[model samples]
Target: MQFVIRKLSPNDRLSIVTFSDDAQRLCHLRSMTQASKAHLEDLVDGLGVINMTNMEAGLKTGHQILDGRHSNHKVHEHT
Candidate 1:
């Protein structure tokens, strides 16, 4: 797993993080605080990692459901 993080602005406390899988596919994009040491630590900890994995799975499932609904809609339109 790899992540790329960049500050939204020089004077801002927000940053954008791009999380990539082993194959270099972008799996997740998120905004986080740049000034919170505890939050940052939690993100790298074991529990946080597990939570992130679960969230990723949920996100993928959501996309699949949305795609199915979109495809169904297209079919109904053609009928």
Candidate 2:
């Protein structure tokens, strides 16, 4: 499989948190607590790195940081 990396906007951050929480909840319901925590933490950390990298790149390139999903608005403007 192929993968692409990019910056994440504020909204994207929020969505990531929300999704992670939801997944954790589902995992708990399914009695997969260990997997849930590990997966969520990994996802959160990965997104944090992506966000930082993207923000830096945007600053260097003089371009707005855009969300991974919605590319219409600036990353900082999402919140």
Candidate 3:
């Protein structure tokens, strides 16, 4: 897998929102804090594609698969 980061623009906003919402739903998260939501939006803006196989195996599991090959930009924040 490969990871690539792309700049965000107004055009991608809807896709980002949809992606974030899907992520939240997949995790069964009740609600996201404003900061968290903003962070996700920022992530989508500074979009990157991560090759999952390149990530540590421990970090790859379960819903990580659904998250696709990219780790959420806020992954480090969570850790």
Candidate 4:
């Protein structure tokens, strides 16, 4: 996750969401600048153990994050 985040350009808007028993949208479409990356890295540090393995919720939240980007967005989440 850190590697992926680091690769994003400053112009890119990045969102981080984690799932366990549920899904959490830690940050949403924030500019990928150095300071913002540091802040987001700190947010990533907050992630700990999770439960239930609810992948559906994770994918749903991801789609929600990217929602207005596409007109026809149909997604599937399989456990």
After superposition on all C-alphas, the RMSD of every candidate to the true structure, in Å, is 11.8, 14.5, 11.8, 5.0
CA lDDT of each prediction against the hidden true structure: 0.31, 0.28, 0.34, 0.73
Per-residue error at 13 for model 2, in Å?
Answer: 18
TM-score of every model? 0.21, 0.24, 0.26, 0.76
Residue 72, model 4, lDDT: 27
Q: Write the per-residue lDDT of candidate 3 for residues 4-79, one digit (tens) a residue.
A: 1134333332123123212221222213444445555565566444433223332343245446544433232122
lDDT order, best first, reads 4, 3, 1, 2
Q: What range of 10 consecutive residues in model 2 has the weakest lDDT sum?
A: 20-29
Candidate 4 wrongly placed segments (more than 4 Å):
68-79
Off by over 4 Å in 3: 1-31, 48-79
In TM-score terms, which candidate is top?
Answer: 4
Give the lowest summed-lDDT range of ten residues in model 3: 21-30
Backbone-clash count (model 1): 0
C-alpha RMSD (angstroms) for model 3: 11.8
Model 2 spans with C-alpha error above 4 angstroms: 1-15, 18-32, 49-79
Q: Give the local distance difference test score of model 3.
A: 0.34
TM-score of 3: 0.26
Residue 73 Cα positional deviation in candidate 3, in Å, after optimal superposition? 14
